[model samples]
Target: MPDQDLTVAVTGPTGDLGIALVDALERSRAVKKIVGMARRPFDPASEGWKKTEYRQGDVLDKASVKDALKGADVVIHLAFSVLGAGDKTREINVEGSRNVFDQAVRSRARRICYASSVAAYGYRSENPKWLTEEVPALGTDQHFYSQQKAEVEQVLAKTLERKKATQAYVFRPCIVSGPRATMLIEEIPYVQLSERMPDAVRSLLGLMPILKPVIPDPGTPFQLVHEDDVASAFVSGVRGVGEPGAYNLAGAGTLTMSDIADAIGWYSIPVPDLAVNATAEVISRVPAAPEKLTWVEAVRNPVLMKTARAKKELRWKPKYSGRQTLRALIDAWKREGPEH
Candidate 1:
């Protein structure tokens, strides 16, 4: 049984999801203390957190993984390489994640949570319109992100099934966005280059919408979950709200390309599906491509997830819709600037 006043361990507390989860846990009565490990130097006190302690460590190191997870009742794995390119990034995401999962099980954590992505389902045209928990994670061969996410989930599932003492709480969320999270918003070429001006010039141009350049809308739909909602769901897991298994997390609905463009004040012209598909394929193969390009593959065939399991089992409810989530991301970007 899990402890009523738990000692929670978190990997990647510096990330957007990490920050949100840590903030949520700080307010959670179930968590007495939160031990957070990340490569970046961070001060939990700066964030106004009381029960959280920040430690400098990389998930790639086994000793760090063991030390961070020591005496943890619930271990949450969030560290991952997103924008990094080449074989090194792949090694960090896949191998480092395996190390964390292995150590968590060995540490005898009562509840282990892994933040998988909808990308694990892959970008397949033949996939179901609405993927449920039952769908097999058939990862794509085009890029390593989806393939690696799928691979990690499969390995974790197998390991945890054998290690019955520990229960697996795998939450697969799609395109997390919120007031504090805007990596995708800042990096996506279409959104980033909408004005085609320097940061100074773009700010000046913002007042004149007619002078702004137009972006081509691919007509692809996507789901966006607020960063806070993601945090709340993980807190539910830490409290052992329901059965330990995979649960899909997303906003209540989907947002079209036009919706995203409107949120950021971009004038968009819809592109045919055929043209967009060809472009996404070419972009995926670009050497040293941005993480945005790899995600573009999913734009070709948007993966819409069904959050029924999360709602019914995890007792989770998302406060922001996909559209509202995107707006929050845009608002955050406008306030903080794109350099972040």
Candidate 2:
């Protein structure tokens, strides 16, 4: 059975997904208290998180994380360092995770939920494909982000072998989307089309004939889950009946780059073989291509998650379908009237 009156400590509570988790836990009757930890002081006025206490803690600092984990029944480690500082990613993802695990052990926290990523699976070129929890890490050296994630998973697996009392759940979430999303076409740097494209772009592009590219093996198809659903899945994984392990939390249905572009009423452009083959070459010479291609591929080739375990074991159900979720994002973009 789950602990109903548990006090939960959520690391990275001020981030996009972290904020959403804080909000979900705050509204739950089962939760007694929520301890939100972050590097900067959380603004109550802007965050609107009530009945919660904020603590300033750095995951990189073991003492700081240990101090924050005091008296916490469950600790959800959501803090992640992606950009800036060369080794910050490994430091936060690996060393910081060790700190959290150490604190959980000291605090006698019953459960620990770690927010992992699909990047842990690394880059793959499989087909008719869906990545399951069983799929081993790709062991690719392409990016530091994926490498760190895979290493952290190995750390947790080894930790689990040593500790039996404390349960750990790792959630591998796909590209998360929602109303307040800062990614996608809107935030793409130098893509002035996001602003100058006009609201009529959706309708105007519909009339003009556009050619869609067809690739033989376009990788595993995936869709973005709403931030709310991702939060709910974490909460469910912590409270719901299940053994501690990894699970893929993704949106309903498999979608491809062409599918998403078509749904959003946009056209897909084929990257020439030269561009595809020499992506790194071009990225090295031309700075803009890296960011541009990153934005484009993020929407284009998302990895779909098999939600059977999440459904059967956790009884998790995504409230928003991928289509509806995308539509909401488009509507929100329309309301916001493009980037300033």
Candidate 3:
């Protein structure tokens, strides 16, 4: 059980998962105060956010992170960079994680929870049918996001090995989905194209069967976890209920590119894996292409995992299935298309 009066500090507390986690904490009588550290101020309009004491801090800046974590009993490190080039993404994801963990140690925090991703397993055909926590997070070098995730896990592991008192909890989640996951939808290049066109033009374009045939097919098998369920796992870890170790987090279903297309009412043109990588290689050279595209080849490979560890250890049974989460995300995207 959690303490009756716990002061929890959450870094990157304004992101999709962060908001859900903070909301969960606020609902718990065990949590008395929440120190939300983010780069900007909280939304003044959110009643749920009003309860938190906002701290304007940057994880990239060690001193600021340390100051923000001073009196925290437990620190939930959610700061991450999902899309960017190598050096820029590493600056925030790798070095930034080190700062947070080091500061948590200096503050003598009892526990630290991290938001890791299944991408840490690395997208490869050789990946086992189901990954376990024992599997090292050594993603391929080409995928900076995957590489950074692995690097951060190494830092957390080393920190715990050196410090006897402090404990670490890492959740390697699959693609998380919910009403708040519109950001993921916006990341799709096709969706961005639709957003740029006029509304009438977009509607007309959607009706064109020929246009749908051109949609890129990302045939990789994947899993989806609800944002709320992930929050539950974190809450469980924070309350000293689960073992101090990494656990996979994902809902109870598997999906592929065709499933994603069906959910969003798009068409999937199945292409050979070789062709997909070839196209990605060409796009990598384009100046307009985001450096994050460097990982396209690696990510096209599937990395599936099971969540039995989280279920048995944390007693975390996700309420929403993977398909449910995907549907929710698609609906959210339709309602709030491409948030500025």
Candidate 4:
């Protein structure tokens, strides 16, 4: 059995949520040491993250993952490819996750905590308003990110079943937002343009009288969770509080496309679901467009997650609301360039 103080190993520790997780683990008394594995070394000067003993390696390479997991009591797998080519994402997200799990099990790590996503629940018109952990992860085939997350969860499932001694905790969080999510902001062109523009231009745009009418409607349900909140859940999982099953992690309130429009003093136009999906498909075909654009359509489904399991079981509560998290991210982007 693992000792009281845990030596944790994290894969992809340079990403947004990964940074948050490292911060959370650093503050926890249960964590004795942290080993971070990433393709490139994180800046040694970063506050709070300097403590992590980062292993310069890739998760796709099984030997490197095994080496990282050598003395780890728990493995926090956060490595995922979101904004890449379809095949590349599959290789990294799916195959890479498989390598991590296999190595963790081989290394005799007692537990594995995975960072799954709400997209794994699949974007369908028939989705329920509040999804729990029991909902099937039938992710849409059209979105490679969603599909890859679901596939990786299956790999985790098989690992938990085959490795009876090893426990697995999966957190399926919705739209994680924070200052560290720089790449995530790039997915929305308007936000990106607004953030990148000069302060005078931004002030001029803010003062434009008729701008509210032109704000594109976000005609889909949005559930935002702060990256720190997700990190807290992983911290709890590593501490052995939660059971070996999937938990839904989300913030307090919900927001719709119209809600966003109203918040920004814009007239909301509820676009038809089919039209949005079709438009997204067309936009994804453009050779120059970022693949993350397809996520716009993939997330159009009306699925709001119920985070009671995380609260009740893991004793995890999000400090920020969805709106609060969103506003903070936007404000941060505006103040600091999109280099999060």
RMSD of each: 4.4, 5.5, 4.2, 4.9
lDDT values, one for every candidate: 0.81, 0.67, 0.77, 0.75
Error of 1 at 266 (Å): 1.4
Q: Pick the candidate with the highest TM-score.
A: 1
Over 53-121, each residue of candidate 3 has an lDDT whose tens digit, in order, gives 887889988878977898888899998877653776678888889999998988898889899889888
Which stretches of model 1 miss by more than 4 angstroms? 1-3, 193-210, 281-291, 338-340
Candidate 1 residue-wise lDDT, 1-340, digit = tens: 4358999999988887998889999999889999999998888899999999878898889998999999999999999986563366877888888888899899999888899999888888788999998998878877677888888898788778778888988889998888777766766655654544234433333324545455556777788999999999999899898898888899987887778767767676676776565555554464544465666676668799999999998778889988788888888888877552
- List TM-score per model, in order: 0.90, 0.82, 0.89, 0.86
Q: What is the C-alpha lDDT profile of model 4 across 9-37, one tens digit per residue? A: 99988888888788888888888888988
Instruction: Kindly indicate the candidate among 2 and 4 with the higher TM-score.
Output: 4
For residue 188, give model 2's deviation from the true position in Å: 6.5
lDDT string for model 2 (75-157, tens) is: 89888774321254567778888888878877888888988887777666662267788888653344566667788778777
**Model 1: ten consecutive residues of lowest lDDT:** 197-206
Cα shift from native, residue 227, model 2 (Å)? 1.0
Residue 171 alpha-carbon offset, candidate 2, angstroms: 0.5
Highest-scoring model, lDDT: 1
Candidate 4 ranges beyond 4 A from true positions? 1-3, 189-215, 258-270, 338-340
Between candidates 1 and 3, the lDDT winner: 1
